[model samples]
Target: MKETLADDLNLLSAFCGVRDLTDLSQNALYQKYQLKKADAFVLFGGSILSGIDVLITAMNNQVATNYLIVGGQGHTTNALRLKINQFYPQIPTKNASEAQMFNAILQLKTGKTADYLEEKSTNSGNNITNLLQLLETHELKKDGLILCQDATMQRRMAATCSKFAPNTTIINYASYKVKVMEKDNQLHFDRKLLGMWEMDQYITLLLGEISRLQNTPSGYGPAGKNFIAPVFIPQDVLAAFYRVAKLFPNKVRTANPAYAKSLEN
Candidate 1:
């Protein structure tokens, strides 16, 4: 017998190990980490709107003094900046969509506020590449960065940053937990779909960055572009979806039957 969408969702919920949303608040984490006044918070991820929301909330709540919103080079980042400017005009902003712009933003945010070298980068690797440029431009010996992004992508970003900027302090602000659902039985499990989605965005970015990097003479070449792929699969993705569904079982169970069926199909 074929399992229903509800079944799949329920299974996913079980795999994810549901945690009470009330207990999952960021307050304790913020307090524990003592993220009172950061030089500038950098929110980088594919979930442009949610990332911006979290960054604005954190700033309003005094979690960070200023913020630099960075993301893959595409419409999302463009739309995000437009929305932010439309909503908050008092805040000074710049479009560091290019590598040079990113370097300028980094220096200004870090209190240097001086002219520096700008390099164009298009993906996570490029973000790191830009950071290296920022470090070189400002002659920074050591620095701390407040990383704000989706919880799913934080680990990979941390690992990448550690490889490139080993001396820099990384303080992560996990924004949200992503859950992936299965089609057959709604089983919830730990998976990489969410991460993969983010990784795909990063991959698209790397493609652009690879083109840019290749144009440079005697550069590292395009090999760095492959670093965006993670070592996980669909199982973890399904589990995460289930876990989130379980948190609101009634909502998952009753949510439009047609939509649920469509998911299975």
Candidate 2:
């Protein structure tokens, strides 16, 4: 199957629709603010290496006083390890959990580490549950929370958090926003960021998320597995999804075998 320039644009539009990236600083450059720092920041480990740098920058801006890094060895573990090995050869990547890898970079770059870490979670569903359990165990309470996750999983993470912590203020600031561009009839990203997904894999991840986001039995919404809250998809997003799906009918991402074993619990 061949994809045209227009097809790629639709793919990109649909991809952006499901993603939410709030600006933590709102374009502040050494500006002062009166808002109190968030009660806590929650970082979800992922394959996107740029997230580490983004979170660090946010920390430098004094976004939060404390944070917890959450992730375990899941489908993205190998990719993260590979990125670390490729970029920072000295870092140990041997069987490193996502939180370990993220914490390693966070420490090396910023001379700091997360206040806590939830390393036993393998998927988004457990990521929230395990995070809550860890907080409760420590008796950590926060009226407001900040969520930093990979752009691909941003919405789902926030939705899951909202479901469990209905009253707490949930602020989303994704680590990266993957914007698709066009040049000479070609579809490409503006620049290559660290740990960037291959174009095909990025599209697969985006489309796969839509399937999970759809309000149906096969989705992660209340009608389905109840993994997250009900999501409303706009008409443009729906149209783009249909267009992109037509171009790549069989390209959606499948769950790793680990999901069945690890998430079942």
Which is the leading candidate under TM-score? 2
lDDT of 1 at 42: 63
How many pairs of residues in model 2 come into backbone collision?
0
Relative to the unseen true structure, what is the Cα RMSD of model 1?
A: 13.6
Give the per-residue lDDT of model 2 (tens digit) for 1-265: 6655455545543443332323566343113333467677788886499888777876877777677889987777887888889998988988778898899899998889988988888888888878887878888876667787877777778788877778877776777765677678667877789988777777787777777877798887889878887878776666676677788888766666566443335
Consecutive 10-residue window with the lowest summed lDDT within model 2 = 26-35
Local accuracy by lDDT, each model: 0.42, 0.74
Q: Kindly list the per-residue Cα lDDT of model 1 for residues 119-235, writing each as its tens digit.
A: 243444555556556556656533556665444345445445665677666666555544444556433434533222343333233222222222123222224433433223246
Taking all chains together, the TM-score of candidate 2 against the true structure is: 0.87
**Residue 87 CA displacement from its true place in model 2, Å:** 0.5
